[model samples]
Target chain A: MKEHVHHLKDEEVNILLNDLLEQYGYDFTDYSFASVKRRLQRVYINDRFPSFAEFRYRVIRDSTYLTYLMEQITVNVTEMFRDPAFFQALRKQVLPVLATYPFIRIWHAGCSTGEEVYSMAILLQEMNLLHKSVIYATDINESVLEKARKGIFPLAYMQQYSQNYLQSGGQHDFSRYYAANYEYAKFSESLSEKIIFAAHNLVTDRSFNEFQLIICRNVLIYFNKDLQDKVLHLFSESLEQLGFLALGAKETLRFTTVAPLFKPLAQKEKIWRKIAT
Target chain B: MTVSLPRTLVIGGSAGSLDVLLQLLPSLDPACRLAIIIVLHRKSDNETLLSDLLATRSVLPVKEAEEKDLLRPGMVYVAPADYHLLIEPDGTLTLDYSEKVHYSRPSIDVTFSAAAEVFKERLACLLLSGANTDGADGLQMVQAMGGVTAVQDPGEAEVAFMPRHAMTVMQVDRVLKQKEMAEWVMSL
Candidate 1:
């Protein structure tokens, strides 16, 4: 039966998700079914579930499997300074305006694994803006949030991340930001102090604070058009007039309802500035 | 058995596939109903260049697949360099920044597996030239899902590792030369 899950119908998937939503409070019906189904297939195959029906039964009956499903659904593929050019553009184009504000609030929505949040903190520290800034990094997964709070990453990844830092215009040695132990590198305590890691579901949560810059890279691509529009609306509401919005390289506002409300500040980098109403 | 025509055509390739693509893309039927998706290994910084180059090959309106773009018939969608292109259940194209599989973003396996799940038997996938075994497992998945599967003949491929690997691992439906592959796609 597990071998046949690749042919699972959208109706079947909807039934499973709807049941999960009814039993648990988590909702995923709004996500694009193709991507969600792809993730679900991985979970089913990896955990050796007999069928989608069995998987759904476990999802409704057991809390641990539900948590595992949530982790799978959220794409946590992130790296420190994943795109150096985007960070370079952020420093050169977005930071100057953010510098003028007495106190800045930046929301890192869907900040999976906290790599980019730490990247931003390092950037702020270099620019001497760390004291005046507060970053609220949020994701729906609590386990990942716990990992983010710990501020430790695999030591093997540090070499590549250091190169990304240099390309992104680092002012000093990238090694200075972390203390490398045996297999993991624990980021400086000061860098971790400025970031508040929490669970914030983009699907259900309301905007908590008006931010000067909202960095939600790569997360919106996982959502459907309606969800993308809803999340964009939330960002618009949560941002100050003329606040900046940054997205992943492939993500754009071209097809969304909120495209008209923001002007491109850096088009290729997918940065936009809110237009004052 | 009469072959049920596919609604989508996916082309997966890697290091050596570009040249074969340049050779094959121009011959695609402009009126074909299949939505063509191309997943090739490429650098993230080489944005728009691949699409621009492929655009010159055909009248099929070649462009990088954008997030949430509806899959239109006769249009050629190349996976954007850095993001995995997925087919949503509604037949719309969605881009993902998920972790790289087989050390490559926009992985052929990721896209092919997702497209196979969505399109099922209504999908046809072709494995082209490359140096790695990336698309072999994906084509196997496609075949397992009862979709049509083809591979570029190893002898004809510039670098045969990709197609050769597929041939060794999976029972693909066709092992055609570049020109024959073009003709086959046009016939579809």
Candidate 2:
């Protein structure tokens, strides 16, 4: 006999997700619905729960499942120098503006596993500005935050990143940035010295400090318009006068509430500078 | 007489997929009864025109799967850009904005494993051309659930690591060219 498959309705899934998030205080209510629905579906199927209601009950009762759910919700798929051209643009345009400042505070928001944060630190070190720079690298995921703090990456992925680094106009041997032992590459403490990796949720958390530059690449796409606006406003408030903002190559400030507050530094690279108001 | 069971066809791929999908779509059996779900690795920000592009070539109705859309036979569903797409037990679609698996929001693993959980032995998983081995673990999970698994021949793939990795990790049911893969899906 042919067996029929049952499907959950969108309204039901939304209610379940909202309940779980609100009870858990994760604030996924503002994230893009399409994206959040898929993740929760995975959790539901993986656990062999018959329905989203069952899964939500399990989530409410089980602490470990809640942790797993949190990990599943906070996608942290970042790579070292994932987009070389963006880094190159940073070197060409933003660095010059940053050079004029006596001291700099840079924020790498949604800094999944700290790859971009380290990339920024290394760039600062080579430019002889590391001493004057303080980088706050943050993500909503604590597991990724711990990994970011450790500064270790698979040795195999380093060669590709090194290639990207060279193409982005690296001044020194990329190997100098890390020490390879066994299968892991531990980045130098000198680079780590300038960085503070922490847990922060852009959706729910408040802005920590005013920054000279905030590089939040590949993070905002997950957010819906309302949340994106709220986060952009937070960035606007957290950024000093004429401070710079860098987004993912595809992300833009054009449609958001804070759009009028920033002037494009390099439109193609998705880099913008805050306008003094 | 009992009606034939509806099958779930899961396709996972990454880099250089547009070319692969273009080639693979025309060979599919339009009359086949299975629901085809495609997981293509893509940037989260760009609008996906894949369904429109593939719809032109396929006899099956092609659309980017929306949240809560029921999975139906004779229709093709593509995962929307940047969002992981999974099937609910009742066959509706669920999108996940959760942290990326293997650095991808719409991770192949997320979808494949989710389908494997719901469909169990009725699922058919396929790995096509891609740069990373993102779908290997998911294929394994599908196989563990007694679902059928297929991999595109690395020799024929635009990027081979994805299928090649799946082949290395588990014994898949078939390694076929895109046309043969289409035929295999029809046979199931």
DockQ of each model against the real complex?
0.62, 0.13
> Best-fitting candidate, measured by TM-score?
1
Local accuracy of candidate 1 as per-residue lDDT tens digits, B1-188: 23332488999998788998898878777777778989989887736899899999876888889877778778899898878788876677888776788888889988888888777788889998889888877887788888899989999888889888988876789998877977788765
Write down the DockQ of candidate 1. Answer: 0.62
Which parts of model 2 have CA positions greater than 4 angstroms off? A1-12, A50-54, B1-188
Best by lDDT: 1
Model 2 lDDT tens row, A158-199: 998998898888867899999999999999999998898888
**lDDT of model 1 at position B170:** 63
* Model 1: TM-score for chain B: 0.93
